[model samples]
Target: MKYRFPEGFWWGSASSAAQSEGAAQQGGKAKTIWDHWFEIEPNRFHNQIGPAQTSTFYENYRQDIQLMKNIGHNSFRTSISWARLMPDGINVNQEAVTFYNNVIDALIENGITPFIGLFHFDMPLYWQQKGGWESRETVEAYAKYAEICFNLFGDRVACWMTFNEPVVVVEGGYLYDFHYPNKFGFRMAAQVAFHMMLAHSLAVRCYRSLKLPGRIGIVLNLTPSYPRSQHPADLKASFIADLFFNRAFLDPAVKGAYPAELVSLLKEHDQLPVYQAEDLALIADGKVDLLGINYYQPRRVKARMTAISPDAPFMPDWFFENYEMPGRKMNPYRGWEIYEKGIYDILINLRDHYGNIDCYISENGMGVENEERFIADDGQVKDDYRIDFIREHLKWMHKAIQEGAHCRGYHLWTFIDNWSWMNAYNNRYGFISLDLETQVRTVKKSGEWFAEVSRNNGF
Candidate 1:
């Protein structure tokens, strides 16, 4: 193989509880924010589809684990639903425990390492009603919940994550109004962001207190910001965007401190979050043992063209704007820019700027609409586009690793077509495509191709 990885390189894909597990109200699981939001605003979801409809991983994990083995997955990641494990976000749910235990044991029996995430944006309806991440009580509840998980299943899990793409949670819930409890404000966003990090630190503390056998970390969707021009304004805009979006969580996750510039910028705007002095001490405890990068696209940034009125709401956009570079590559199906080198830049940045921390490509995949349109006579998707996408990204990743990057693995965004948040199933992102109407699974060309890459440790 020309582009080979290190010995024992982990090859698998990631999944989230709310996105893949379809037994929403079954097996003694309660409602999450996704369920509640779907109930109230069904139209917000595509075709009125919601959390109750998924790939049915909850009912089919054994078969999915066999599929993982068939596709050469040595490691796989999927999160536990907080709403399922702790219906009230405090007490334990034994039925959920047995179900998760069976899933974990099944993956082990299939020779696939289990990477368990404690939270994956599936805030329990119980917690959301308590002000979600806004309330410090929610943070404490989350920490306690983390302790319960560690006590129950830490024995078999190899990796644990506190949260995933926390910036999205901050952006969607507070700044942009894309998620449940959607609001628009920077002050509350700041508070929620801080509390989330604090909550992460608390979870890390709990994991350490028990001295679990595995590593603990968080998965961040790191979007490398590229400036539109060499102009100083454009450069500054890129820096600020990175500060607010990337470093907001990355810095505190790996570095143990929020960027001084970030704090000063928030202070200048009177947007500092309400945090106790001891919170910093706790935040220091939350530094991760591993970092997971979810890179799908790069953020193209430019200086703001127009000034914001003094009466207007303060937001991240107050400092910068996003634009598409003319002639840049695009993923038309998902409407996202495709710059394969962005993965290289992200890995290089981590190597040079973030102490070469141990990390992995936790998610990098292409989502396409109506993938069935490419079905071959063999009754499988001839997704050559997706295969090329993976190869291009992997070439850059291989280059990064050759340059002494501490990247250990690459896991695709998903293993199978599953329900997405607001987009529902509009865009399919999986090596194995699913027919939701029939729950039929068909391995795509990319799946077979990836199996070869894994068996050979390269392309």
Candidate 2:
């Protein structure tokens, strides 16, 4: 193995409850925001497909765990559906508890470590009705819910995450129109972002209060921002973009604070979110024990040449302009740039700037549209492109590790081709491909190769 990883490197994949668990309306589970959104505006989803029907992890988890073992996975990550566990976001659901326990027990039985995440953007409709993350009440409820999960499952689950890609919740739901309850405004975005962080701190406090046997953290999708040129203006633009996207959450999670520059900029624009006097101390308590980074692309920025009118809505873009670099590598299947070295850049940045924190690649994989077109004989998907994608990214990541970055593991975006929100399986990203119609799972060529990589501890 030319690119061998350190001993005990974790190789696995991630999926969320909302994306993989098909019993969206069954098992005493109440409606989630995704379920309700699909119900009213089914047309908004691809192929008019919604979360009501999924890869059926709820029913097929046992078989799936066996498959994971066969494919040489030593760890796996998935979220518990808050909506399923607490239909009204207050009381416990015993049936859902039984289901989750079975899933966790089965994973251990098969020699796979379980990484449980509490929230993954699947807000219970009951909570959404009460203003979701925007309301302080939801923040308090979330902490209570975290405490319940800890008392119930924290003994066996040694790894936990408070939320996955929380900034996406703020950007997608409040700043942009891509998500449900979409309203475009910076004030709402800032407020929601603050409340979610507060909720994370409270949950961290709850976990510490119980002294659970696990380490809890948050998963962030960290895209490294690069200036198009070395010019000071372009550099400043890139710095601001980084502040808004990466450091906004990273600082609080790792350092128990926000960047001073970000605070000054927000203050200059009179866009500070309303926070309690004690919120600062609480946020300082939210520092994580581990960090999960999801890296897929890089953001290239340039100085803003045009001025924003005073009446224009304040957005992160107002301070910088996105610059599309010519001749950049791209993944045409999913319309995302393919920059393998960006992984190294991110790891090195963490090593140099963030105290070399313990971290791992939680979600990194290629998604291909119409992947059935690549099927080969012997009933397997001939996904060489996916193989090359993983190998190149791993190569860069290996270099970072060699340079003293504290990266611990790498997990693909998914285990099976689960339903992606809104995109709904349009782009398949899994070592095991799924037959949506018949619910069959077949290991792709990359899966065989990955099993070998796991067995060898690298490629």
Candidate 3:
């Protein structure tokens, strides 16, 4: 059987500035929270490696872009490090500007479209000290920074994303304490989540106000919440999970409003964040022109069997519990469940309930620890497992597209194995493998397969 995508389907991979571009201190790049976190507690990162120890994309972008071309990438997504572009999130760094201009130009020169993301969890440390996303001041400052990006690089970059996975910032930073400014308070989490949405909306407004030529959108890692069983309680649990995790940002970005039930629940719990009266209107006016959906896994949940004590702190988990279904397939390396059908479910939900907005799979890839174990005798990773993972998901994506889902393209998580946040290079999820010691890149089996897929526009 043969499967083909649309005429101009974007076939590429995604990367981030902080993760790929080393030279943390060079290029006039100020310290991001990742850099600061490593400075304060070096051991927190994997193998004591930090943001400074990246794939050195800053100095080697031209070579990397050539690799992208060799891999048949027509479009690629990478973030502009807020700290790198504006050292203090205010002053423009000319060195950083020159570096980025070269990067964008190289992508264009190679016949690849540049999909530039404004933020990717690398908040400037100076902004963190000023209360991070929790402060309205930081939100306003981010709006200004976003406008600066539009004026600087809007001419070359056609596809713009306001933020990549805003939910990760809320869950990792405020809930799980995995990212920087780690805090574990329900109210504070809600406040940070609200303010991040406000910042995204403000950036969207700024993009529109500039009348930019290209499409502007937000990238959300939507983990479709699945209930354990057909029981009403389990169904209710799934509903709440989706509302909190998916709709928290999806609603405003696409539907131009917050989910009313979610708002009511927050108000009832006195967990609403501080916001100006006009903020809702701004959010309404800032609906996205496109959506980037990053689906790596689905959230399988069930109604909580145990009731929490009244004195217990409020958390989204209070309403449900993770239900590990029997015999569920799992990615042993990354510990994420392998649910390929979740991609189709997500697209169908968007099509049926959310107006079938224009979207694309922004990030989807398997991360494996100690991937060197899979290296072949020919000096390439025989990543057949990753190839299978992508193929299965793409099959479902193709089905959804055939069923009238407005999905545009599919981009894997990354082009090269770069530095992951605190998990710094531990879980490699790229078509091209990066050699840390030599800073050499090798195209893996998956890369060869992806090139063919891009060339044929399908399988």
Residue 5 in candidate 3, Cα distance off native in Å: 0.6
lDDT of the candidates, in the order given: 0.93, 0.93, 0.92
Candidate 2 per-residue C-alpha lDDT over 1-459 given as tens digits, one digit per residue, 9 for 90 to 100: 499999989899999999999998799999989999998999989999999879999999999999999888999999999999999777899999999999999999988989999999999999999999889999999998998999999999979999999999988899877888777788789999999999999999889988888889899999999999999999999999999999999999999998999999999998999998999999999999889999989999999999999988889999899898999999997888999999999999999998999999999999999988889778889999999999999999999999999998999998999999999989999999999989999999998899999999987
Candidate 1 residues lying further than 4 Å off, grouped into runs, are none
Worst 10 residues of 2 by lDDT: 175-184
What local lDDT score does residue 381 receive in model 2, on the 0 to 100 scale?
93
Q: What is the TM-score of each candidate against the true structure?
A: 0.99, 0.99, 0.99
Each candidate's number of clashing pairs is 0, 0, 0
Write the residue-wise lDDT of candidate 3 on 1-459 in tens digits. 889999999999999988999999987888999999999999889899999959999888999999999999999999999998888667899998898899999999999999999999999999999999889999999999999999999989989999999999999999988988888987899889888888888888888888879999999999999999999999999999999999999999999899999999989999888888998998897799899999998899999999999999888998899999899999987899999999999999999999999999999999999889989789999999999999999999999999999999999989999888888888999999998889889999999999999999999
Which 10 successive residues of model 1 have the least lDDT summed?
84-93
* Clash-forming residue pairs, model 3: none
Per-residue CA lDDT of model 1 for 1-459, tens digit only, reads 489899989999999999998989898899998999999999999999999969999888888889989999999999999999999766799999998999999999999999999888889998888898999999999988889889899999999989989989999989888998898899999999999999999999888989889999999999999999999999999999999999999999999999999999999989999988898888888899999999999999999999899999889999999978999999998889999999999999999998999999999999999998999999999999998999999999999999999999999988999899999999999989999888989999999999999999997
All models, RMSD in angstroms: 0.9, 0.9, 0.9
